[model samples]
Target: MAGYRPAVLVGRWGEEAQLQEERVRDFMRRRERGELLIQKIKSLQESLLQKTELSVCKDGCVHFGDTVLLLNPAPAEPGPGACGSLALAVPLEDSSAYSAAPLRAPCGVSAVQGVDPVGRNTFHVLSVDGTAVDEPIRFGQKFGLGTTGGFSAQMFYLASDHKSFLRFATKSHLQQVFLTEERSYLTCWKAAFWDPQLRLEHEGFPVPANSKIIITHCHTNRSLAVPRNFWTRSYFGKEYEVVCHTYLDSHKAEEDKNCWEIVTGDPSNRDGSMCDRPDPQPGGVRKELCEEA
Candidate 1:
């Protein structure tokens, strides 16, 4: 757990905004009128957790241009339901929030402030040449999350001013990973399979389809990971933070926190049991799942 400290170690960045009295009045008016509604989704289930999955991929190895889910099962976050495990997602779903929900405008993602957390968001795979072919993406090769004519639903992708790419920057020992509006060298990421049992890295092989895999930022050479304690309050409530820092304590280059299963084809249903709490009794999480973090 040496490298798994909760704090990001990176400085928080954002732009300034004016919180006008009118905006406060508007929020108060909305709160008084019962218009500030909170949305909730059913928590984590072993079978594909998403309801609106796009049919871009088939039941085989993950391919370039396939729309996929980055299903993360680490942290074992405590939430009502379905939100138990984390999934890589952006802050606001769309730009309509800034105009429609004026009180949130000052927090920064749109104009200057921002956030990246775990939620149910889909990403597309692409090679550097802009090819979204039916070919399987292999390990140790250059690929990226966002591409031309590919599906992207994150707030950054949906907005007009920002670029849609997952990028990282290393400041001192901390690697600050984030979504950027730039499509430069920093957006490149390569997948390396981690053996489930042995927790070892596999290179130069075809990445398995709909299986456990870890993505590394090409520029920082850090694995995409979720912090156990770091989090932020979002429109979707409290969500854990997403980072790209390789843990020294991880088994060989594969840590449970860094593991993300690819959601290729139909992620609609499963046995309908939550992974963390199978039994409905108090303190009923299975032994293996409740292992100390």
Candidate 2:
């Protein structure tokens, strides 16, 4: 993990404020444009489906642009239902044919703080426990939880001060209750990271096209590289680290390690094995592994 340095607002207070405002306006303009491109891409996808005479199921199908199809077997399917896989559809003669159009803000919708133009939702900074968290959600700034917990949970508010940061509650610190005010930044090493790249193939959204973003917190001072391990808790409360070799062969393990490194800055163990590391904190015993890292 590497530290993120925020852009400083230089000059006198008034001048700095004006500069910040301009930066925010520019960001909103770009975001609006991105949203419009996404919309056009979605429309193109629907057109492709219609032309191919293939109807996307309300469930169990994933669409990407206008040429990809990921299928997940329904539970009622014969044999193992979990063995869904990816398949390509409608290859284009020119890849550039699927290029998305530039986006424009919807008519009558002003770029306002705290509102998502595409989703039509108000921005709110929320705590892990669902309470409204207050902080200046400024553009190019990072906000972190100020606690003594081992997990790193922070959010970077990109391009706008009005959009709310949403924090999905996690059962990371089950032993203690986090005070609303004690939320600070976090820095940690040795965590599990799961990439469900194909899990959401069959889903529908209110918005024709959607994007999901995940945020990770790291130290603002130092960069750390650590190996990740998977762990499981037994019925008697003991925890055991899961070695990848036990389940995946050498070739798959190496491929997975490479992909994991690409997705997460952390590298897999040199031995190509997943193992547990001893905790330095007093009385801190490994109880469970995080599903998402």
Candidate 3:
């Protein structure tokens, strides 16, 4: 055999080792970059905390990481933008409860169930993200408002001086309602219904056992549906000549026996003069007091 063959060097092994080393180096660099970004964000948040007056609110208007509240009488439904169907209110005062924190209300149904202001004559917390104002927002304070229907309305602050809140008026605040050229009507009457539980009767209304009558919104025009949960405890005489109607089943017709005969195909021609006054109850009938007939 000839003298030992010259040793041959294959560079494949060396190349693979270099490639693995490069990958390890790249991974370390990326991790360091992520750490730097996290630190920068932390710094920015700390800086903002020093400037915002949101830390001074003590009346529950400013809660950190909690949903605030808004009060509006509009019916709940899906709509455009951050509020969805719920309303919005700006905070006016800084109290100890809201002091030293940032506030946020997440979008979607959380905005409704978690943040919406619901109740009558109570203070409502409105969460916000920004610098707090100088004084506590209270009754008579004014806020700029915009609506989805291109309608601009004023949101007056009617809350008590004790705490931050949005006030809902039990009395009518509408000075006048200007309708279009369409025929409209406003009628008031007592609501009647049967209640197995009879809870509503305790609240108000005269209900006989096994009777299936209840207050509901009904429209004469086939194309339109009645507003949801429409009820008014206050009843007054007809001021406008707009016409609307309500229907009574055979059972309800038998309750009064004589008052149920007032229906016509066109609700406008029906005799509302015979419509009885609304019963004195806490929450009265399913009456259409303000609507376009």
Candidate 4:
């Protein structure tokens, strides 16, 4: 209204308009780049989820992708490439009925049952006589006798009660009996705890279904052997020195049979009465039996 605007003022207003436009364009470009980066992050997350989905096992174990969560941490801390106390995860669907159920026992005895990762029961100790024996079979504890017969046979006798010195007559095949040491018969036996197939065979013949294998611990004291006088009263009448000759020259092929013999004692009484047998010499078999044999 005052005639006309000054040239300098007009020029300044034009410059301000151009600066605003440039700012708008720069903001738009930055927003576009930001949107593209967000889309790429979303796409990567979707791809990783598809490859490894988290799941839970029935035994209350968690499986995150391909890695199993460790329930019990190992004694030594887990380092790189080391699976800390990670055990084989047993799926809930594969759990056996025996393992899933709580262990039940009569009065005065407590039975604790736990299932292994493979869903096998770790506490069931099967007796050959079919009677349930709740006593835990310790790793290094002395077990019953392992005998062999001449016709290529092996038998296990459970050391159970006082009524009979050798309690049960449960017999298992030699092949089923796992001797930890082939050279020393006194070594601990390796019992099969878990075999998914549940078949232990020698020469195509499977072991008996009722056979209860014995588990052995290698680190335990080697002195945990069956006492020499274990079957003295049962086999003879009184206590007599008995020696276990696991290997013999005449019966080399039959290690199980004739493995035991009276070192010094007389079983002359048929009525289970103790006879006055001569004492064992420093290093000699029974004097009377030596002459006869």
Best by TM-score: 1
- Cα lDDT computed for each candidate against the true fold: 0.50, 0.23, 0.23, 0.24
Q: For model 1, how does the per-residue alpha-carbon lDDT over 1-293 read when each residue is reduced to its tens digit? A: 57756663534322212346568889898767545533111212111123433334444677886666566764444444334455555434332232333212111121101111112355567667565577788777777664111113322221112122432222222355555555667678877766545334556667876467777777667787665455555564665555667664444556576777665544333311122223444576666666653
| Residues 202-266, model 2: lDDT tens digits | 22221121112112233322111111122223221212111111122344321221111111000
TM-scores vs. true structure, each candidate = 0.55, 0.16, 0.20, 0.17
**Candidate 4 at residue 173, lDDT?**
10
| Clash pairs (backbone) in predicted model 1 | 42-82, 43-81, 43-82, 43-83, 44-82, 108-113, 109-113, 109-114, 163-181
| Model 2 regions more than 4 Å off | 1-141, 144-181, 187-214, 218-228, 236-293
- Each model's Cα RMSD: 17.4, 27.0, 22.7, 28.3
Q: Candidate 1, residue 165: CA error in Å? A: 22
User: Candidate 1: global Cα-lDDT?
Assistant: 0.50
RMSD in angstroms, candidate 4?
28.3
Please list the residue runs of candidate 3 whose C-alpha ends up more than 4 Å from where it truly belongs after superposition: 1-11, 35-134, 139-293
